[model samples]
Target: MSRLYGDPIEVWTRDGEPSQFVWRDRLYLVRRVLDHWVVAREWWKVREGDPGERQFWRVEASPGREAGSYELRFDTASGGWLLMRAWD
Candidate 1:
């Protein structure tokens, strides 16, 4: 995965699933959610007060005719989101 590393974004959700997201001044509509999972923080490796669990979604998205697979993570503690990776 390509680490985007804290790029802020806007997401739209319906029924608690991501329907679309805005990143880099463009909107990508989610076509399908391929997978979902949660990653709990590693207490031994992570410091206290760091963001807790992360909810991840592997999705297929399209901005008009261009399409790709993307991995997105949501920080449960802070309610912040990241675009972790994109495959062209």
Candidate 2:
């Protein structure tokens, strides 16, 4: 399990459009929202998926400007972004 110690964020997105979210000290540009679904099992995955899980908002981002629909995942361990999914 990963330790989640930081400010949570609220995300706002639209269909087929980029997303926008803000954490505590920085703002994030959502590359894309991927494979959002509800998960009601495996408490372990709850770290990434939680109890009564309703969705997985996957995304991708960098330290600079972003474009198009891309996939980005936030690592709860390092507080960084990783590319998980994307569109061509």
Candidate 3:
């Protein structure tokens, strides 16, 4: 099972894709992207003509020894990255 954190993080990107991420002072390197998708904000929460969308990236990353799966979310409106969930 994955644990949801929704914690803010710092991510480094290459070619508009996450290449590395820092969470809780630890760095993890992205090995490969497992999946990608976009989610639109709830219609009621978004004003007309507002591009309220979030992008999610499922990636296999490793801090050192072995890899773990992580879901990263990018908020277009806030221009922030979050560590949405993680699996060990």
- Candidates in order, TM-scores: namely 0.82, 0.42, 0.91
lDDT of 1 by residue, 1-88 (tens): 4445457778899899999999899999999999999998877755577757899998999888878888888987778888988876
Superposition TM-score, candidate 2 onto the true structure: 0.42
Ranking by TM-score: 3, 1, 2
Better of 2 and 3 by lDDT: 3
lDDT of 1: 0.85
Give candidate 3 regions above 4 Å deviation: 47-50
Choose 1 or 2, whichever is better by TM-score.
Answer: 1
lDDT at residue 42 of model 1 (Cα atoms): 76
- lDDT ranking, high to low: 3, 1, 2
The whole-model lDDT of each prediction reads: 0.85, 0.46, 0.95
- Displacement of the residue 59 alpha carbon in candidate 2, Å: 0.8
Tens digits of per-residue lDDT for model 3, 1-88:
8999999999999998999999999999999999999999988787666688999999999999799999999998788999999997
